[model samples]
Target: MKPGAVYFMANRKNGAIYTGVTSDLIKRVYQHRNGLVDGFTKDHDCKKLVWFEMFDDLEEARRREVQIKKWKRHWKIKRIEEHNPDWDDLWFDIVK
Candidate 1:
């Protein structure tokens, strides 16, 4: 089975954030970056991949995504900063 990932995209450091889950992280993130996926990410211009966590089980990833989505904004920001203090675009890291 394909690996699954829970990811966070942001417009900039401490900017609007969009959290999602995908079976193909690279393709999904690419779509968001290029504005192929309509809705929140596109509307908010949250195209920079700032953080992600891979999971062996797609269901687990989905559950995590849902959990994160319900979190308060500050909690979500804290989680992102814990892993990515600088909020660097993680696209390079994933593609490389």
Candidate 2:
């Protein structure tokens, strides 16, 4: 359906932070949660879905993802705060 750049905030409970962009959020997150995908996320246990932005264009989403990747930690936190001020784990919200 919609092309999106979804980033996950990985942590047991408000712990580690992980940012990622994916076209398919559901499948991607499932893999992260299940530890099917190895690397930074799996090693750090960063499975909290915090903030995500949807874009109709894949190019736009990719552009945003790249931009975010270069952003400073505070900048990323500020961006996330725009929607999730409390930084609550947004895992269940997406499924509903």
Candidate 3:
């Protein structure tokens, strides 16, 4: 089975965040960055890939996405900042 990923995008550090699950992380992140996918991320301008977690099981990624979505804003922020204190836009690394 193909691997899947749960990723979070932000407009900036401590800014609006959007969590999503995708089978192709690189493609999905590209779409979000270019505003190709409509809805919350586009509306909120959350194009920065601040955090992501890969899973061999698509179901696991989807479940994690749902759990993170239900989490408080601060908890999410803390999680992101823990691995990515800088909240760097990881798009560059994954893109090329």
C-alpha local distance difference test of each model: 0.94, 0.77, 0.93
lDDT string, candidate 2, 57-84, tens digits: 7678888888888887777777777888
- TM-score to true structure, per model: 0.95, 0.85, 0.95
lDDT of 3 by residue, 1-96 (tens): 778999999999999999899999999999999999999999999999999999999988888989998999999999999999999999998878
lDDT of predicted model 1: 0.94
Q: Give the alpha carbon lDDT tens digit for every residue of 1-96 in model 1.
A: 567999999999988999999999999999999999999999999989999999999999999999999999999889889999999999999999
Better model by lDDT: candidate 1 vs candidate 2 = 1
Task: Name the 10 consecutive residues with the lowest summed lDDT in model 1.
Answer: 1-10
Flag regions of model 2 displaced more than 4 Å: 12-14
Model 3 global lDDT (CA atoms, 0 to 1): 0.93
Output the lDDT of residue 73, model 3: 92
Q: What is the lDDT of residue 36 in candidate 3?
A: 99
If the candidates were sorted by their TM-score against the true structure, best first, what order would they fall in?
1, 3, 2
